[model samples]
Target: MRAIDLETQVLAAVERIRKGEKTENDLIECKRAWPSNNKARQLAGSLNRAAGDAVIYVIGIDEKDGSIHDTSDTDILDWWSQIVGQFDQVPAEMVRHIDVPISNESVVGIAFSSDRAPYVVKTGSPKPSLEIPIREGTGTRTARRDEVLRMLAPAIRVPAATVLESNFSAVHYPPLASAENAANDYRREESVHAFGTADFFVEHDGRDLVTLPTHAMDGIIEVGDLSFTLNVTPDWFQSETKAPRKEYIDRQREAVLISGPGVVPLRVDVEGLLLSHRKLLETTNSVTVRLHLGILHTSKPLVIEMELNTNPREHQLPEDLNRWSVRGK
Candidate 1:
C-alpha cells in the first residue's frame, strides 16, 4: 500500500474502535498494551491471511472498552520486531507501521497487505509446531486443508499503484526577456512561468507490495488497457495547449509495460500548460489540475484521483522592478 493509503487505513481503524462500531474481526485487532511474542505471532498470522486486501493491527486502544491509551512505552520498531521474528514462512518485511494520535496521547497502528496470504506462524515451546492460522469473524483457528489450497491459488490479481510526485506551482513575473516597444497598446502573451508534474508507478512484483504470482499477474490486469485524463480548472488551458495531451497518446514518449517482475512509471509534465493561454496571468494567479488514472489491478476498474495547485503569487518578481523590460541602449 502507498504511504498515504496506509496512514488513512490506520486512522480509520482507530476511529472505528473509538466509536464502538464493532468488535475486532477479520480486518482489525486492538490491544491496550503490547502483546507477548507468542501473541504477536498468532495475531500476525491470523490477520495476514484473513485480510483480503489489507488489515490494521492497532495498539494503545482497549479491546474491551475501546478507550485510547498511550503507546509511548515502546516505539514502533520494537513492536514490529516482536511480530516479525515469529513468522517462519510469511514475508516479515511486508508489515508496515504508523503512529496514530488520539486526544493528547498516541497509538501504534500496524498495516499489513494480504497479497501474500496463507502465512505460517512458528509456535514457541517444548512442543513447537508450525501452523496456518486464519480469522473467521471475531475468532481465529487453524486453516482447514481446503482453505490453505484456496489461498494458494490467487482468485484475483492486480498490480498496486502509488504516487511518486504530485506538485504544481507557478511564478508570475513582468516580461523580463522581451525587447519589444512597451508603448504599443496591443495585448501581448506572457511566457509560462508555471511548472508541475504528476508521476506514479505500477509494480508487478512484491518489491512494492506483497507479490502476486507471475502467472497470475500475466493473465490479469493488462497494462495496455490503461487510460488517463488531466483535467485543468480552466478547461481552456488544456484545450489551448494540446501538446501534453498529444504527448500522452504518443507511445514513444512514455513506455509502460508489464514485461517481467518490475514496475513502470506514467508521468505528466505540465510546465508549459499556461504557455499560450491568453490572459492566463491576468484572469487568475493560480491554476488547479486533477488526474483521473485508470488501471485494472484487482480485476476491477480502479481510478486513482490526485489534485495539484499552482500559486503564481509565490513566484512573482521582486518589488524593485514594477515591470521588467529590455532597456534599449
Candidate 2:
C-alpha cells in the first residue's frame, strides 16, 4: 500500500477491533494498554502465535466497553523491546505503532509482520523465560513440539527456485555504468542494491494462514539477520561444455547490507569487479546468464534460495565498454 493509504487502512483495522467485530484470528489481536514488565512476558508468545500473519495488536482500548484512550504517549521501542527480546532479532519496520482516533478518544495501535516469527524470542532476563508461545484462542500459551513445527514450517525450505518468477520476491541489479562514463577499473564505492517487496515471499510455512489468491507473499514472513550470496553461470555453446565456468558472485562484491531499523535502503558494492567481469567474457558470449542468489539470515545463517535467468542482458565484454548496459526484472 502507498504511504497515503496506510494510515487509512490502519484506522479501519482499529475500527474493526473497536466494534467488537474482529476475531482473534491469525492476523489480529487486542490489548488494553502497554503492558507492565510482568505482562510483557506474554509479548514474545504473542509474536510466535502470529506466525507469518500480518498481525496487528490494538492497544489502549477498554476490553469490556471497547473504549479508546485520550492519547498514546508510550515509545514504540519500549513495546518493541518486549516483543523482540533482543537486539537486531527483528527490524524496526516490521513493527509499527500509530495513535489512531476513535470517536472522541484515541487508541494506540501496533502492527507486526510475521515474516520473522517462530525464532527464539528472549528478554535476556532469566530462566524459564525462553519458552516459545503460540496463540490458543484469544490467549497465548506455551507451544508444543508439534505446534513449534507448524510455526517453523515456512522458515526451512528443501529447494531453491532455479528460474525466477513473479512471486519469488528479491530483485537486484548493478547500477548504470554507461558508455560515456565507462571505466576499466571498478571503484570500491560502486554497488548493486536488492530491493524486496511484498511480492518476494519468505519460504518457510507450517499450516497455511488465511491468504487470498490476490495476496502477494501471503505466507512468506521475514526471518532475522539477512545477507545474500550470489553465483553466476555463463551460457556455454560451441567452445566446450567440459570447461564451462562458474563464479561465486559475492567474492567480487565488497560488502553486504540489509535494510532494518535506522537502515532504510541498504547497499553493497562489487569487489575487484573489473577482474571478475573480465573472466566472465572469456568463457562465453551473452546468450544468457544464470544467476543463483542465496538469501541467508540470522546470527547462525539459514539460507532461502532464489535462481534467475537474464536474457537479452548486457555483457560487459573486456574488449569494450561502449556497449555495456544492464536491464532485468
TM-scores, each model vs. reference: 0.45, 0.40
**Best model per TM-score:** 1
Per-residue lDDT, model 2, residue 189, is 35
For residue 43, give model 2's deviation from the true position in Å.
3.2
lDDT of 1 by residue, 1-329 (tens): 56677667667766776677775756667788877777755575555555356666777888666678776877667766777787775644545777776667777777777767777788665465777777666666788887787677654444555655554433444454454644462335444443344444554453222322222211111111222233222111123564653222112222233432332323333333344443443344223334433322332322334433333434455421111111112
Query: Candidate 2 residues 195-270, lDDT tens each?
Result: 2211122222222221111111111211122223322211112334577554211111222222211111112122
CA lDDT scores, all candidates in order: 0.51, 0.41
Clashing pairs in 1: 158-297
Q: Count the backbone clashes (under 3 Å) in each candidate.
A: 1, 10
Q: Cα miss at 11, model 1 (Å)?
A: 3.1
True lDDT of residue 208, candidate 1: 28
Query: Looking at candidate 2, what is the lDDT of residue 50?
Result: 54
Per-residue error for 70 in candidate 2, Å, reads 2.8
